[model samples]
Target: MTAGRSRARGVATAALLGALLSTTAGCGSSPSAESAETDGPKSTWEEPASYSYTLTSSTQVLAGTFRVAVRDGKVTEAVGADEDSRRQAHDLPGEVPTIGTLLQTLDRARSEGADTAEAGYAADGRPVRISLDWDKNSIDDEALYTISSFEPTPG
Candidate 1:
């Protein structure tokens, strides 16, 4: 009976160790864009050639990355997760948001003019935490958007 109990305990220990090892193993050299969250120092804002993003607003959010065709500083096309969204996005014209539009918003905040601009970045200098408002201040904040899970797509 003692031996049986010992074997069970040993099995439990091995299971725990295996789970720990597997979790650590996933954090190897190549981290996916979703994995590259910035809980660290922020450097200059460097926009990748192309990327995927999750846009969150006060009311709604793009469920996943929306690919787009950029032409002359605008989103010419908005690619969605499915065919229905694709058609809707494409039909909306400039109403849809894309990687280009997000970057353009950041750039405009500096060069064009913004009411308020506060941002945080990742180790790789991607903007992870952003709070920009076209109107109002921290007290009565409105029109502020936060972007996250930004992963650079290979050009």
Candidate 2:
């Protein structure tokens, strides 16, 4: 192609890209923008007096079972299955996502289009599953987390 024609095509392409970006730049809300008042009583997860659930990867690999009671925002009586999980449930303090952080991530996924790679939630506002990719639109099966068999720990 002629230099003039090539330059014209490049300019057109750049203009189109610019227009698309400008429109989308302001399209989404940040997680911090989520209203505290609008969230009401359900805004934060109530510390489950007791809780139990199985954690799994996107590929359905069992990470472990987390069985514990919260006696002041801390896990107690922690128990975990051994055959399948990588670590004991008691080791979850740093290994896995907490209820508060996971919920914030899920909320961001709902409001911020580009922030989350994939996400799902329970009907009662809990993180049933979640994944994060930030700027990339790719899936990481390893990052995929599914919380199943959620139940309040029985006395």
Total clashing residue pairs per candidate? 0, 0
Pairs that collide, model 2: none
In model 1, the Cα lDDT at residue 125 comes to 57
List, residue by residue over 28-109, the lDDT tens digit for candidate 1.
7764543343322333565565665655432122222345544444454566656745655665555566544555665666
lDDT of 2 by residue, 50-144 (tens): 56555653221224455433443444445555643435444445444445545565566556654434444465555655554444433221244
The 10-residue segment of model 2 with minimum total lDDT is 32-41
**RMSD, model 2, all Cα superposed?**
14.6
Best by lDDT, which number?
Answer: 1
TM-score to native of every candidate shown:
0.43, 0.45
Candidate 2, residue 11: Cα displacement in angstroms equals 37
What shift in Å separates residue 115 of candidate 2 from its native position after superposition?
3.6
